[model samples]
Target: MANIKLKGSGYGQFGGFTPYGNVTVLAFALATTALGAAAESNSTAAVKNGDVIELGILPTGMRLEDAQVIITTAMTAATTGKLGFVYEDGVDDAAVPQDAAYFINGGSLATAARLRASGTKLVVLPKPAKLVLTVGGADNAKASDIKVLVYGELTGPK
Candidate 1:
């Protein structure tokens, strides 16, 4: 396990060298990856903008994030709306917020928000705690198997 502590949230001219000083602060961070191998099936999801799809966790302690699905075979246009992931068992599949969602625009890295005619390179965003990643795809295309690469990190505010 890798460990690191930032001096502070922001740079200060006369900040204390250690946490014993005033406004002491501490933070915890971790990175991990998970997988979900299955064909896109009766998966229920909707794509929109600024949506938060919280993937689950890791054994050591971390969160899940979105990722690009690097497939050797070209993704068919008909496959539009088929969500892919690099992480698995790492999705927020529940009420209040479902496991998967769609963004009107593509992700910061790739347009995972929509279909990439030929393919796509999904962007990985930081995930919160207590959620696993579960890749969603076209509700119609659930029968077709889509390989997703899920990767992300978990950070705690102290």
Candidate 2:
């Protein structure tokens, strides 16, 4: 589903064009090739010093417009690392997840600081949740193998 139409024209008072006509309709859906990646403790360990890892979930009726977080292996200072997203209320099967909803807040892995960061693409109609991707201030002694890549789409009823 893809339909975008935006037309505008209206300004009279003392400006000029005043015929009057403005239309805006945007609806974009259908995006899912099934791309995935998750890592925080899948081995290659080395994250400590304020490490809050999770990084996974969002498959049942997906709806994550876009997300990216990668730090191959470079975390000395980490520039106060932070790659975010959290909202998993599974009732009781807990494992450290109080509440979070960060869309790439305070993100930096400092190896030149630009490992990769993206989030913010949803003009409405984005539900079907269950997401967790956390990594804040990874210790420092060279943080260590952290990778998280979450791509979106699957707006229900493929």
Candidate 3:
């Protein structure tokens, strides 16, 4: 049998390394939980501190489609940072942004745009703030609402 050293300078012995029936259970630990799905009040999920969180529909029902989308929230506007994505003809082909898209990506608070084609994937990576899937798309020629699934560990104070 083996033994372990205890703290408090008091020598306490624990069961040595073993197989079944050798080391018995002494104690257990608790677990932690996470937040629920919901947009925060007073703009909990809104853009804060000059953050550029990718826009996604809240409440999980919006469908992806081709149209003019106005991000009324003050966080989406930017004269220049990144267009991130572009789509047309049911595809995000190789071409420059045109009339309906080029301007939507650059603006101010409550003014941002996005585009999507049927059966294509859209991805957005933000510099600040967190993203989640708010809505999803249905059939063709419809608007889709999706949550922004953030990738990687964000290190900072909340």
Report the lDDT of model 1 for residue 96.
20
Q: Write the per-residue lDDT of candidate 3 for residues 47-149, one digit (tens) a residue.
A: 2332333342211111122223333222322322212232323233232221222213332222234322222332221212212111221111211122122
CA lDDT for candidate 2: 0.42
Q: lDDT by residue for model 1 over 40-110, one digit each (tens)?
A: 32324332222233332322222233444433332223333323222243565242232232222232222
Clashes of 1: 33
Q: Is candidate 2 or 3 superior in TM-score? A: 2
Candidate 2, clashing residue pairs? none
Q: For candidate 3, which ten residues in a row score worst on lDDT? A: 24-33
Q: Give one digit per residue, the lDDT tens place, for model 2 in 36-149.
A: 112323544444545555544554334344555555554556444444444454442243232333346667654533344444444211222344434455444442454455
Q: Top model by TM-score, which number?
A: 1
